[model samples]
Target: MRVLLVDDEHELVCALAERLGFRGVRADYAVSAEQALELARTTAYDIAVLDVKMPGMGGLELHQRLRELQPDLPAVFLTGHGSELDFAAGAARGEAYLVKPVGIEVLLETFARIAGPWDGQGGRQP
Candidate 1:
């Protein structure tokens, strides 16, 4: 599925994007909320993986803004903080949450669960 990966860490974003690519998942990386918003406006991404703690616009805020643009698309929060409050917020928004340093396999599984079955016919068509 097409995924928008939003994270401030350049290395993490690049690594994740590359790993996703290797798995045949189409992933676009955005370093900031504004860039993600801009990308969302023009592209139809199936899911957004956002970092909960960002410099300017946090993941929750970004999630809200993304909903305004693409309400149907699902968003998953990739956070380092494992707090009840963060989990609650993600749950309330009908979104998934994953901790940092996640294994690529787990990340793929989480994306599959959140984005639904991939037809395997082509690249992240779903």
Candidate 2:
């Protein structure tokens, strides 16, 4: 599956990208909302992993914009703050959210749950 990961934390994004790559997931990353938006426009991704608190656009706004571009795209929000407001907003948007420091197992499980199977390939159906 193709994934676009957006986060301000450069180290975290790199680490997560490496981990996802090792697991056979194609992941491209962006550190800012503008870059994420640009990437979204140019690429077809099955899932978008977005950090809730970003410099400019933030995850919620980014999610909304992304949906405008590709309504069916699934998004997962990751937040270090774990604020109730963020959680509520994410829930309202039908996005699956995870707090920072989330384990690989949890990440994988969440992705699998939201990313439905396409035949026997294990990727999302087009």
Q: Which structure among the candidates has the greatest TM-score?
A: 1
Cα lDDT for residue 27, model 1?
86
Give the TM-scores of the predictions, in the order they appear: 0.90, 0.89
lDDT for each of the candidates?
0.86, 0.84
Please identify model 1 stretches exceeding 4 Å from their true place.
119-126
lDDT of 2 by residue, 29-126 (tens): 99998888899898888889999899888988898898877788889999998788889987777558888899987887787788854332335557
lDDT of 1 by residue, 1-126 (tens): 788999999899988988888777888999999999999999988889999999999998998899899988788888898899988987677467888888888877887787776754325544
- Candidate 2 stretches greater than 4 Å from native: 117-126
Model 1: lDDT to the true structure: 0.86
Candidate 2: worst 10 consecutive residues by lDDT? Answer: 116-125
What's the lDDT for residue 57 in model 2? 89
Top candidate on lDDT is 1
Candidate 1's TM-score = 0.90
